[model samples]
Target: MRRRGGARRAPAAKEGGGAPSRPPAPPQREKLAVSTPFFAVIGLGAFSAWRGMFSLDTVRVLNAYAFLIAAPAMVLRVMSREPVAALWNGLFFAAMALLGVAVLACGILLFRRLAGLPFPTAVSRSQCLVGGNFTFLGVPLMLAFMGDRAAAPIVIALIVDTALIVPLSIGLIEAGRGGGSPWRIGLRLVRGTLVNPFMLSILGGLALSLSGLVLPEPVDRFLLFLGSSAAPVGIFALGIAAFLWARSGDLQWRIVMPLVAGKLILHPLLTWFVLAVLLRLDPLWVQAGVLYAAVPIAANVFIISERFETGSRPIAVAIVISTALAALTYPFAIWAISG
Candidate 1:
């Protein structure tokens, strides 16, 4: 059977066969080698952050491409192969959606109890605490640890969380603010969410997943090749964003500290708790939550603030500090919850 997101088939264990017909072991070993470069990518980000030279926004775009570009492309290929019955294997996606919403809620609750901060402070902190650097940090990290094919679930998670979870949250949060027209705002939101690249990709991927559809050989290779670029290039963009942040030096400690704690510690725990307790997600999913949990705050928080005159100081600081501390926290989180 053909698989999604990769050209490399796994090596099945041979029965009492005289000689095995396998795609050379070297390729398989090389496939796992993807892990090595991922570490290098992380190191590059960390180093770039320290040196304060590269462009962090560039990293952001790299991340944007995975969800914005590669994800949809891969989804098209994956969609081509799914079976009818399996197309509705949406339990995982639905579960993930709940997890995203829950994390946002947890961030708000934690912010209130721990900090007693004001509205914008709370909003900024909650946004960072809830919505992670899912695209930039999570993608590379997952690709490194899991490799290309296995990264599909996390990619799906990324797309879903971005297109559906975040937009909905923002829409609700802004609903009471007395905009031009509530109906108009609602309509805009619907259109925005519907046409969202990430959401569309998820739908496509889910269709393919359920249908058990297979892609043409050339298409599969192309998807794999593009999907594979996600980690390294994305990390580079993150580094560039960091450099820009460093140059700005607009660090705000008030919003920063709590954001760091909630994102690095509380968010992951909330994810694990929600998955294992509330949703009772499978172990693999629980692991996915754990891994994705360690992602930094979105760089967009800063961009949105800077570009639209909104404030995301808390978001920016969290992005910087959370990532810095996650080096220690992530592995511990995996060890603590995963085993």
Candidate 2:
């Protein structure tokens, strides 16, 4: 074909030295965003427990599905396609390391200078607040509000979970005084992360979206139907995790309440101020920040506790407690920025 003002554009280069002038587009992520006070309903349940309005059992189921089933499915679908280089690059690893370090470093500094609490208390509080329930609450909550635009923020959340959350939690698990293999622990961490159902499902959905492959009408309809269930399932799972977590005796109001305070209030505010005001991040990014902040402390906090036997019980209470309290704070945060 004759070129119009393009006098034979340079021949497409070969593989080793020069490739195509443009890099292939990154995969497009697709997500669901549904925003209604869905979480408010959850808050009500948690609140009921607090007020003796309803039993806490309702909350445990909500948390359970989100963590156990949905999250693993979503992650597998997503992580399966991760470019090998993307998985292995030192720079990416470093960023995650720094974020993880920042979590602990900030935790120590804050606890020492400001919290004036025990070392473990400071550490647990910061860790729970900074990291989030990305796969569980984050996916649905964003979809409820932002819909398909939910995809990008979900991506950011995943990166945060993989790079920041996983490493930090492992380090905390292995704290000092031994010859246990760090790599062994790291591998175990990676293994657990990779198996998250919601993560896998999101990845599957995103893959289809990026491949220019539309689900057949019936399939699409089914997915939509299933997708609609995302929030309720998540909330129920939250309820369950909460219920189970709540049963532990002598609930540490001193530690648990502070973690809730940090997760529900401070976390979102800091994210909004930084991402929205300071960085002028994309509006979607701001939304992601809000999602990150608004999410209750992760079930993983309890998981880490269970695994390493680090303060798991309190963290569990914190997750359940934070989520319920978040009902009040989440809406306000959204309202503040809705302008």
Which number leads on TM-score? 1
Model 2 lDDT per residue over 79-154, tens place: 3333222223233233334544565567667765885855544555567867676565667666555544444455
What's the true lDDT of residue 103 in model 2?
54
Model 2 quality (TM-score): 0.68
Off by over 4 Å in 1: 1-39, 42-67, 74-95, 106-121, 143-156, 277-281
lDDT of 1 at 79: 40
Q: What TM-score number comes out for model 1? A: 0.73
Please state the error at residue 91 of candidate 1 in Å: 5.7
Cα RMSD, each candidate: 6.7, 9.2
User: Residue 110 of model 2: what lDDT?
Assistant: 76
